[model samples]
Target: MKRIGIMVVAAFIGGAAAIGGYKLLEPKGGDALSFQEQQNVLFASNPKVASTGAVDFVEAAASVSPAVVHIKTSYTGNSSNQRGGSPFDMFEDFFGGGGRGMQRAPRAASGSGVILTPDGYIVTNNHVVDKADKIEVILSDRRKVSAKVIGKDPNTDLALIKVEATNLPVVKMGNSDNVQIGEWVLAVGFPLDLQTTVTAGIISAKARSIGILGRSQQQPTEEEYEEYQRTGKMPTNNSIESYIQTDAAINPGNSGGALVNANGELIGINAAIASQTGTNVGYGFAIPVNLAKKILDDFRKYGAVKRGYIGVTFAALDADEAEKLKIDDITGLYVTDVVPGSGAEAAGLRKGDIIKKVGGATIYDSPDLQEKIGRMSPGDKVQLTYLRDGQLKNTNVTLKGENSVASTLKPAVAKNTNKATIDKLGASFAPASAQLKTRYRVQNGVVVTGIEQGKLFDSWEIPKGVLITSINGKPVNSSKDVEDALPATRNGMTRISGVGPEGAFTFNIN
Candidate 1:
């Protein structure tokens, strides 16, 4: 009996020492495990119940709803003071309508967000907190905390925010590339000012671009409006809209919510709704998690998205477009023009090339290419498969920064030298005739004799027979004078002062 007791005591001591050693060497709870792994371990016993049917969303909804947060924002003035073009007419649903003009009393608005990290990293739509003065987030446990915007990308309509808290529930990020049509998904959010709501639907489509960012994006000041009025074009819109379409009943206040799979994995971020009445009409859109992952990571690393550009203006081709362009193929994007020093130009892409594939994925429309390129940054190499004169060819192009491309296109022309800079203007010029100068009452300038499509001058819509007085605030009697007067940049803007058919006008090209 004594020997047995001593053996039992020795065994207990060894067991205690083993446990203490593990406690010292094991990964610390917060730093060792990622948010997903932590959650997995926490719910190991109550594992995600796989859906047996397409409509079984009970497990998914329960898991996702806890991570979908309610975000309330306060704006100092009216929210609807600025407006432009929108391919999707769902802005009224995402942001409540208000009158334009003067500043109004402070107002409150609400939206949804998905917690991405236990330390309070959240993802939401940029429009939700675009101009908000203060933001408050309500968690599943009904606890309220203030959040600060970490970064915002108006181009993609996505924003990252964080709160001063820990142990927050997080939704696991899933592979959006594997999301299939007709697969059941859940839209979880706080919609129509209600509590956490979950609606089930199937994936309706993929790679949908609706052009909604222009409507809710920030507008330029009055001086900047001169370029828009002169050019008759919306200011350079770099908005990327490769959304995953769904039938999920996302309504007002659903912006920035979670669109999760039946397994409760986040596949997309609930963004827009297509409804004529500002309510659900069986059409909704979500930013694919595949794209959001890159964007959110960019937001975390840099304060803004480090977007890369292919530097080619293109139009998606259909049977009608192919027939119009006299092409045999009915699919692919028709490359209209390549930027002077862009990756497309460096890769030998010309005016009539057809872009069929990016990397290895086939390109059916703008979104397919835009979203893929949107995921990359400057200096990234992308393989392109295209057709030159009906012969398929491939090339690897190294993307360049926006500033590098802009600088490559010299914005001015000097005398008799190659005419390269003049060509860059996309317009032919002639010395202003004396009679023409007398009629227009301008001193010395050049006439816009001809304009080319898809060129800077054409984009400005400068008509033929227009007389110019000066460029960059210097008198220009010839192309050489215009060139000498132009500076590389004035605060990174090219200023053009000229008299057109409309009247004497001055505008800045940004």
Candidate 2:
């Protein structure tokens, strides 16, 4: 019985070894032994195995760690699902190989932020702090500080946050507009709680749109409402039509981070990625600095983007449309209409005019031209280049900045129609020509830019644009004359004197 048992054990052991051997030698759809084959995975999985390249990734990671930062944010409501999307959280598990609505509770989210200004103006994706209740910015140096929201533009999905500090290292703004496909670039941010993590790639394309922010959306909805709730102010959305496309392996926490050139200049603000499986598939987009500059200026001056308006809309021009329009070439923005009496109309610009440039910059399409014009304020004159009958004409047009260019911000002061006093007069005026000035250009008056659209100014014996030479017979040349001419109309209707678009004309008011 002992001999029989020993024989059975030896046979079992032999079968076990044979099965293991078969697994080791199993063919992975190939007849030859190859390093990359599945049969060789056991060896490949071992740490002692070498990489495909001569370089070491460990050294690169160590070098990038110091520059990365972790960002942690706490917000109201249930936010458990997003708890891991932050840069800090990202970098925390980044070495281990790691939004909503899908277990996806609204979890507190943490991610990375990049220190752009040494004095502590960190830039990160607007989504990271969109509705944060408490935002805590931690530096790669392990210092934590409370960050205040400075300005955020959602159309581009970038936000600028300020922390108290000085002598800080500010990343030089790079020209994302200048980046082209396949050009070397770098990505710096906190991913998975890891700090100063650096990744490298190349410019994959230009003006790439991934639709992550949605069309015509400037500020994220949640962020805008928060701004309103905190300060009783509303933010303006600046449409982002220009973006720098890169292949820098941008992941979730990479939003609002920096896309720098080899010179370490910030060319673009990393914005979005394209993935069928919810991760980077080698496609990403960033807002160009040119557009970001305007957003920043709007934030500084008006609390929101004071977008310039032309008051006319049109469809994008395709090659077929260009041919139908008899365009000489395809390198110009076709003007479909001139906003009646707006800046474009006042400059003799017509519906058929092809806008070739704004200021000194050549514009081949509406997106580029609109973005440039949108950045200007009213009263800021810009030169326009257009083609009229194969003849290029350059004309200068003054913009309107207030209602059109003033801040889009809601007035904090109550709308008090009740001023100290009420002064009503039946008079109107507008800018006078040099000849009219010769008669008298010293009146503090502005041309009746508006006549209540078909009221006293319309029925006036004078015509529209008829330089309101005077108001109530008061010597009127500029806007001041009309104001001075305003008579206390407590009694009956009043008559005013003015010049018509052709010659001297009269108008009446009450």
> Each prediction's Cα lDDT score?
0.74, 0.54
lDDT of 2 by residue, 1-510 (tens): 999999888767765564455356655522233212321332232222221232434443443344445667776566643433442232222223233212332346666665643346566666677667788877666788888887776555566677786544445454455666767777777544454557777777665544344322322244444444354333323355556777778766666666766655566766666654446667666677667666664554445655556533333466877888776566776776444446766788876777777788877565677657755766678898888888999988877543542132333111122222113433333343322222222232233433444445445433323334445556654454455556633356555554332334454555
CA-RMSD of model 1: 11.7
In order of appearance, the predictions have TM-scores of: 0.70, 0.56
Model 1 C-alpha lDDT versus the unseen true structure: 0.74
Residue 499 accuracy (lDDT) in model 1: 70
- State the lDDT of candidate 1 residue by residue for 115-230, as single tens digits: 98767889999878877889999999999999999899878888999898976777877778888888888999988889999998899999998766643333333443444235
Model 2 stretches astray by more than 4 angstroms: 1-68, 78-105, 192-194, 209-238, 323-331, 405-510
- The prediction achieving the highest lDDT against the true structure is 1
Clash count for candidate 1 is 0
Q: How many steric overlaps does candidate 2 have?
A: 66
- The per-residue C-alpha lDDT of model 1 at residue 414 equals 15
RMSD, each candidate, Å? 11.7, 20.4
Model 2 is weakest, by summed lDDT over 10 consecutive residues, at: 413-422
